[model samples]
Target: MRKSSSLINIKEVLLSTRKVLNENAIIDSDLESDLLVAFALKITRAQLHANINSPISISEQKTIQNLVNRRIGHEPLAYILGVREFFGNLFRVNESVLIPRQETECLVESIINYLRHKSIESPKVLDVGCGSGVIGASILKYFPNIDLISIDISPNAAQIAYENILKITNNNNFHVLVGDLIESIKVQVDLIVANLPYIPTKRIPTLQKEIFLYEPKTALDGGTKGVEIISRLIEQSTKILKPDGAIFLEIDPDQKYILKNKIQHLFPKHKIKVLHDLSGQERVLSITIL
Candidate 1:
């Protein structure tokens, strides 16, 4: 990169980034600007805005240019930062695990409310396919009395999850295992939550560049129908969940019609509800054993 071209000022770089991000992009250009700028300067949002005109240094300029270029190409900001916020806590993220989405927090909130008011003896949680341990850790944050067990098929994912959950919680008596769902798990629990891979294989390539390019395909590619994992999960969940326990799954809305029916058939006596995200698309399915 030429010093002359690279010598473009911070203000100019922000303008260039904004221009490259088309109007139809999911994230607004302004938000992308803030994220890229803050990331490049290694400063907080407030600090970035406060020092926007402070004359970005040589390395800072190079870093800012590259990140902004990537952003303009539709890369996800979380991938660039290598961290994501979930349930009000920061967790390390990469292609190894699914980036925590806001919709999952709704599921977490529901569980927290249940444990907060209801009286139960030693509430236990099983986070099936616990990538990065994000969901389990969030629940652990509030319900310390609860025993938590998280399992993942990938050893790499298990390692990251273990490191993240080791000393972050008080009781810290949780279990992390590397194996397939339920079969590898031994204990019965009050609740089982999963943010399993639900995106249909054919639909993955059409996703935004950030998601398709940066995030791992295994964490997003739901089999041909998108519910292959969920189907297996529901079948095993009945055997693993306590008699009165429940299971929560994050899913794509388009699959609900069939998913709801399958849930009904899989656990005929259970109460099932299909939840919708902010966009009114059904995304979570919760079933409680009767």
Candidate 2:
């Protein structure tokens, strides 16, 4: 697309981008426009504003337009930007892994809070289905001394998670392995945390376009009943978790009762607590083996 004027500046480009995004019904068009423009220019949003009046090259404008087109085509903003912030830290992201969501932060918080009170030093943590390594990496950022093992079924996803964990924590206390759940795990751990795929297979198509169309299907589908993978994980936790160990999982609110029952059956002498996100939705499940 050709620019309306020969000397198009950053301000004009941002306005035109926002207008196009708004026309396409994209939410937060203003912020998205700023982010896209800044990303295209390899600059920060603050720098974009400071140089709003500066002229933009034709090549630069074309780059911004390309990104805007991708967004309008239903690609997620995080994928387009190649990064996402979680628990106050930014992690690299791509199509190989699921995009980090704010609600998952609740799981990280609960783990940190539990560890803070527990006397276990250098606790071993097992992160099941570690997409992009956000959960384990976030916890390690706060507790650098802890040993963490992150496992993912997809080799591509595992590689991305490995890179993200190393880049974010810069600590050698974690291992990212490619495996399905905890089947390959032999070492007992003090905690098992997972944000596994929980959306039922039938419900996958009903998700937003950015999710269903672009996000990895393996990262979203949770088998037929939606709790199949989680139930398996809970059952597997029985053999791998150490005594007085705990398990924290991010789950769909609707799956809590079913999962709770499964956990109760498998871990009869356990304490289970459901945590609510800011929106009051039951998001995380904490299971303490007593």
Candidate 3:
């Protein structure tokens, strides 16, 4: 974004942003440019299109320039804008929590489908590492009678999840616990869904800078083999879940066997199934107690 432009309109601002970002090899430069412009105008995407030629005030241009500079420095666009949409709802996000990914939505979908198919009325649900509260919150929004307890080890993540849960639904049946895995809970649940930290410790450095540098390590690192936190969650869930309860987890594509083996070794009677996202990549782990 050139600061020396005399008079700028929304169209010119977006075009300039796209050019600068594309030049720097930024992915999705066009979408990022549109979102930044919409954020600056405080308007919806539809409104942005209707007023594409509207003039941007001098103050607004300067503000957008600052955001552009931040993005140019490899900062996440979600962090720069202060929000990200997940499962069709906007979630407040910062450096404290991982930005909700589209693939994780498969975890939510699998849980919903299981609950409905089994006709599990008043299902007690536990969301482990519930960053932004998107997973559990989406469930509660659809099933108001469902009991949900969402837990995260990070205080900032817990706070953001709490706020998102409240704003997303009026259901008071959900609880946000700030703790590691299921250590903070005593009661058994009908289902458990986790999007835990499963990235290998050594591979964290190999991830995109936006993830390794910007996101919290506690919410990303999975210890030596990338199953430390996930292993703990499965072990604890076996004790706190009903005999016929189920657990769903989001994981890296390569983690399918390692995670399943852990579950089998810990809970030999449990049944496990791997699910793939729309792109046909192995993404979620579904475990049902026998």
- Largest lDDT belongs to which candidate? 2
Q: Write the per-residue lDDT of candidate 3 for residues 48-125, one digit (tens) a residue.
A: 889887788899999889888888888999999899998999889999889999998898899888888877768889
- Candidate 3's displacement at residue 194, Å, is 0.4
Q: What local lDDT does model 3 show for residue 140?
A: 93
Off by more than 4 A, model 1: 1-12, 22-26, 166-171
lDDT of each: 0.78, 0.93, 0.88
Q: Local error of candidate 2 at 75, Å?
A: 0.5
| Residue 158's lDDT in candidate 2 | 91
- Candidate 3 differs from the real structure by a C-alpha RMSD in angstroms, to one decimal, of 2.7
State every prediction's TM-score relative to the real structure. 0.87, 0.97, 0.94
Candidate 2 per-residue C-alpha lDDT over 11-65 given as tens digits, one digit per residue, 9 for 90 to 100 = 9999999999999999999999999999999999999999888889889978999
Tens digits of lDDT, candidate 1, 1-290: 33364465667667776776654464588877777878887788888777655666688777877886676666677777878888778888777887778888877776676678757867888888888888888888787878889889888888878877774565577888888878866677899988888888899999977788878788888899998988888788767788888888888888777777887887778888877766677777787789
Candidate 2, residue 218: lDDT:
91
How much does candidate 1 score in TM-score? 0.87
Worst 10 residues of 3 by lDDT: 1-10
